[model samples]
Target: MDNGKIKHIGVFTSGGDSPGMNAALYGTVKVAEQHGIRVSGILKGYEGMIDGHFIPLESQQLQKTVHRGGTVLKTARSERFMAVDGRQLAFKSLQDNDIDAVVAIGGDGTFKGLIAFSEISKIPFIGIPGTIDNDLAGTDFTLGFDSAINTAIESIDKIKDTAESHNRVFIVEVMGRDSGYIAIHSGLGVGADAILIPESGEDFLQLLKKVKDYRSEDGFIVVVSEGDELGAELVASKIKELNPEVDLRITKLGHVQRGGNPSAFDRMLGIRLGAASVNALMNGERNVMAGILDNQLKFTPFDSVVKQHQLNEELYGLLKTLNT
Candidate 1:
């Protein structure tokens, strides 16, 4: 391969770490190898970009990491990247290293960083959504989301078995900072008596009333997001006030949802997205995200993705009706 014709592609994992990141990296590297291009792994997200923490990513090493959880390339969040000085440093790193393009594996916040980096250096970027939150704007499904929901429901199912045996009222909290995808899906899958999310904005008192009604009729199981406005302790205390004999309890599934080997669905999506990102770069697309649309790979410019896909209304509506 002519050295002058060889392109250097940089890959990084940013924002909240999730499973399947390594798989995406593997796919990108494998596809790039077909074109005689070299790949570099940037550690610790954009902070690594600023500090130049990177290593050569060979196809051999990438193959070893495809089945792994979390990123082989470590991740970090740096507020510095939001500023001019930081962007300058990142651009300087790329120019010095001859990086021709970047494939960013992250959620919304990291995608925003890619947009900023592109604006500063005019470098091409392709994003693969890889967060457990599943809150990324444009994608119908984000990598690690299915795995997370599966992890959460496993816990929920376990809790359900115990709650059923004891005839108890248990509230299991899952992860979802602002989105309800995890809680809603897990609740629906496991037949949760009630599901609470940020979008629902259901009042604590009303929630208590519903729980009380459930207890009166039969035992209850609720799945709530950790970001739910009301804390589990607060809800339990209010329930006690209503009935001193109530056996209401809370189990917060913190970080448990983000762990574990990604299920089959996530691994497949990771492969598809990872390959699609490489195709986007080869096609001269820059500052864009690759996502699955109608079971097909599709590309959307970052600006349009940010504006159009945040907080999907149709899915939210279905979640609401399911709760009812």
Candidate 2:
């Protein structure tokens, strides 16, 4: 439970892969190696841990990966790990490999699994926020969020060119299973005519009327989050129904937003948080997440990180005001 007692650490990326995961891995490995602590890469997350798929890692192994996209250790969802027996197997693997602690990188589900595993194992764990959804609490901005919003905005910018050329209405759908961060930011960035987010109750008729009222020679652009009740397709259909003369198109960004190299902002955030996780573990911290709040490093309890995050009303209101 102390720095001297910790000689080896296991690191893994769980749940969905994010753009800044590699940077996080690199930072962890580099910091651990600097302290003469051996590092093991747990491939495919808890599933790999239970399967004993530990790979040796050092500072050199992570060279040139800070700018890379996705995770070098890969990631997967393990339903089996939710059970006690699966956690025993993972604990056995950690014990057999002499891993003294763990650094888990991912969203809420990853942290929840780590917490469950800790209930049955003696090994300590630290979490890093690395989801595109930006739904995780404790952190003002999760890793890959900036990259994802930039990616979505770039795609929207291109779609706007075509929408304007064709003189038609274009509805772009972005990813956000339960959050509207992506849609709101991208919509504001692209100066969308209207944005439909799950956080804001849908008003299809009102949206259609807004489009009709905003119609101009430059064409119309609407952004919709995937979590919205009326997705891009449904919203586009309703708009077309309300105004038959208006030409309309739909584009779903899909997983494309999850791809791409880590931006400078994301890379730095990953490195800072990753190193902070190692420091937390070395200082005898456990069951905590290292995050950045207001540009300062802070550690938060896992329970708070998993709690549901409310939508940012001020930002949402700003979007409406800007469009109006």
TM-score of each: 0.92, 0.96
Off by over 4 Å in 2: 202-206, 213-215
What are the per-residue Cα lDDT tens digits for candidate 1 across 177-253? 87778988898889887777776665454566665545443457878887677756666677677766767778999
Q: Model 1: how far is 183 from its true place, Å?
A: 0.4
TM-score of 1: 0.92
Least accurate 10 contiguous residues by lDDT in model 2:
200-209
lDDT of each: 0.81, 0.87
**RMSD to truth, every model:** 2.3, 1.8
With candidate 2 superimposed using the best TM-score fit, by how many Å does residue 212's alpha carbon deviate from the native?
3.6
Tens digits of per-residue lDDT for model 2, 1-324: 225877999999999888899888888988887788888999999999999999998777687888888889988999889889999999999999999899999998998887788788778889999999999888899999999999999999999999999888888999998898998899888888787888777434447668765557897888889999877777877777777788888889999999999889999999889889888888889988999888889899888888887887898778667545
Give me the candidate number with maximum lDDT.
2
- How many residue pairs clash in model 1? 1
